[model samples]
Target chain A: MNRQNSNKNNDHRDDFPGSFRSNPFHVPDHYFDELPGRIKSRIEQDKSRKRLFYLRPVVQKALLAAAGLALLIGLAIALLHERNDVHVYIGQFNGISAPDIEATLLPSDLDEYTLVSFILETQDFTGMPSGTDITDEEIKSYLLETNNIEPLILHY
Target chain B: MHHSDEEIIPLIQDESTREKGFDRLVKAYQQEVYWLIRRMVIDHDDADDLTQDTFVKVWNNLDRFRGESALFTWIYRIATNEALAHLRKKRISFSFLALEKTSTAAIPEYNDAFYRSDNAMRQFQKALAELPDKQRLIFNMKYYDDLTYEQISEITGTSVGGLKATYHQAVKKIKKKLSLE
Candidate 1:
């Protein structure tokens, strides 16, 4: 059976005319000589590329984390500075009287009624002059000196 | 000196001697691998590139070689796969064209003095070209490379009986094609 199969295989070869074994292909001279070097260079390049590929995302993540931390630090510093300014202003007000504090805090353009109400709530009336005692000229002079006449005239 | 696989494999497996061993390996088998690919691809440039690619793969995968098969067979397997894959990609990208035209396009120009006078050679090459890529591969291994069914089977991972049938079919087709021409 083996011999028969072998002969049959030979028969298939016998059917074809002429040898098909002759190589029609040719390469440039020294192609084989230079191929190893070329392949080595490619391997080296591939190794370098793979190293970079592994390292790239790590480097990028580290940089991103650093940038995010810097932003958080800056925001915290800004918020702390604003809070400190508020605290400083509050500390300065602790030493001043209520009238002085009201004068500094209130707008100069407050109307007479609002100003009187605010002072009545906060100040002592024992030493202060009454409205009937003060002449119209004295009131006008006080308003002028305080730069509050324009708002009073506009209000009226 | 021609280094055997026993000598080469050990050198390559060692990091210190790896490059030198690989260089020796390439020098020893480059021609065999080149011709194996050249016949399958039928174009010198494609074969050259595939041969280089095969060696690069061998280099990358050298550590995993368990010595279950001959190193030559392993290398041939790589070269074969590269050729078949190249042919497959070409077929897919150029599916719009007729198979005959696609195969003919791969034929080297007949400007060579040897090819210009040999009509039989040209007809035979054309017939071989027309076969399916795997069938053509089988035919080339048997007819040109003179590899046995057992060796071809080892390289191709095809059963011997199947290889025999495919090779027979290839021979019949080439004969018919030649007679028709």
Candidate 2:
């Protein structure tokens, strides 16, 4: 099969009768004489390039990965610091009790239903308020002791 | 300066005589390797650059030679690889559109002073350029360089039978392109 193909190619070449095979390209004068020196210089230049700053692909990838890891760690640390700051600010009210939260609630902050529940939880069915000797602290204590009502209804 | 591989390998291995050995190797194989690359690239300048790259690789990697193949075959393999890599980087292919682009742009104009003024040669080059990269290499190795199928197989890592068939097909294609078929 190979011989047949070769013979066919030969016959084709014969039929063509003008297939030029000699090298048609020409180089600059003295190119061959100077090529060895050029190659040597290039090799030296590459060696210097390696010595200066050429990093292997593996090393470059590792450096990128390390940098990414460091950035992630830094962000995590920053988030934890912010979280700790919030904890510290909340801890500042250590001496206060739940009454302080209830004391800060505006009238607008409580709906009418909550107001009714509050009233039922705090006061007895003694109708409207009269000019009696009922202290605010006594009312609060009744709210706390009678129905186990939490004084802190307003969220922060 | 015509040192055999046995003589050149030792010089390359030795620290003192390495440069001298390499010089001889370049002198011995440079023309053959250059022409091989030249045929593949079809431009003298690109071929020149790739030829230098091939030798530089040879100089750096000659120490790894384990005598599995002839030194020249190893060098041919390196040269072939350099040429193919350059074409790949430049996105050159042997498709019809690619051939048109190469003929118009990549190939040095005949008006260039270094280009030969032979129309037949140019036509043959055009016919050769129409082949795919591997087929072109096979044709160049077998038809032009007169390398045996086994030697080409070593350089290209293709089986001998495959290379023979490829070479024959390449010839047919070139012949057809040249309007000889």
Candidate 3:
């Protein structure tokens, strides 16, 4: 063991003339010493890059999802409105009946109903209001008495 | 005392939390973030924009973080996705490949590969840009970020095996294109 140890020591003797060598333990002094401004600048640059790298997908998805949700709601509203408009119809006329018995004659005086039992459909195309709450017998008598002129044609 | 990335994330959850912890997290991880983005984007400005975008996302979604992955991995995922998205929107010219004898003669020479190559990094950037978007994302997460296939699988909703295949294929294509053995 002593002989082996001696040989090992002798072999290592030429490898290092002294225990302290400067080769492995050196760096430029300023390499470890940074000015505050420089360090701060490096830090800012770092933060800037990191911030961008971390937020990319989330920001994009947020904007895209918001736009998508808005479109969906808008489309729904538009579709509902279109559906509502599909079932409607409109008819225009000048008058109602009761004591008046105008029978929905047009404002333009296009025609008059000469028949006693012609239809008087509501504007909604449903049944009429039963001759505006007047009796049919009274309406007929009144029409006969006035020679079929409108009862409310006061000047006549 | 400085907080770890995990500690910093919760501070990013609220607007005020960001006010308190954002600068800290930025200071803490900026070098890793910058080089990662810089290497991927190639251009300094593009890197800058993408880096800022990464943080804003972190700030907004800090609350959603469930501690399932390391903070480093999570942020890396964001960065990779952003870099790929930016690349997708870029309209680099294919004119370099077009012949002068063709009508494309009037076009100028342009290639996405020119700016980024300083080392393997440039090739990595180009390879990343060339890949289909999701594959590029998977590559970035796998190669640079050092994320496991399982973590990437969850983040991207891809199967782990699929991600592995994508990463392997991407590596091969990049190697072939860049003439690496």
Clash statistics: count for each candidate: 0, 0, 15
How far is each candidate from the true structure, as Cα RMSD in Å? 9.7, 9.4, 16.6
- Collision pairs in model 1: none
- Estimate, for each residue in B101-180, the C-alpha lDDT of model 3 and write its tens digit: 46432431212233223445444444445666667566655554455676677666689889878887877787676675
Number of the top candidate by TM-score? 1
lDDT by residue (A17-114, candidate 2, tens digit) is: 44465556677899989998898899999899887565677788999999999999999999999999965744544455656745644433545455
> Looking at candidate 1, what is the lDDT of residue A148?
48
Error of 2 at A11 (Å): 11
lDDT of 1 at B39: 76
Candidate 3 lDDT = 0.55
What tens-digit string does per-residue lDDT give for candidate 2 at B1-181?
4566777877887879988989988988888889999888866888889999999999888778776778888999999999998988987754544645555445443334225646555556667777888898988877766677877888899999999789889877877766762
What's the TM-score of each model vs. the native?
A: 0.67, 0.61, 0.41
Q: Which should have the higher DockQ, number 1 or number 2?
A: 1
Task: Write candidate 1's Cα lDDT for B1-181 as tens digits.
Answer: 5677878888888889988989989888888899889877766778888988999999999888877888888998999999999988887232212534565445343333134437788677777777888998888888866677888899999999999999989888988978998
Which of 1 and 2 is the better model by lDDT? 1
lDDT on C-alpha atoms for all candidate structures: 0.75, 0.73, 0.55
Q: Which 10-residue window of candidate 1 chain B scores lowest in summed lDDT?
A: B92-101
Candidate 2 wrong stretches, greater than 4 Å: A1-19, A53-156, B93-118
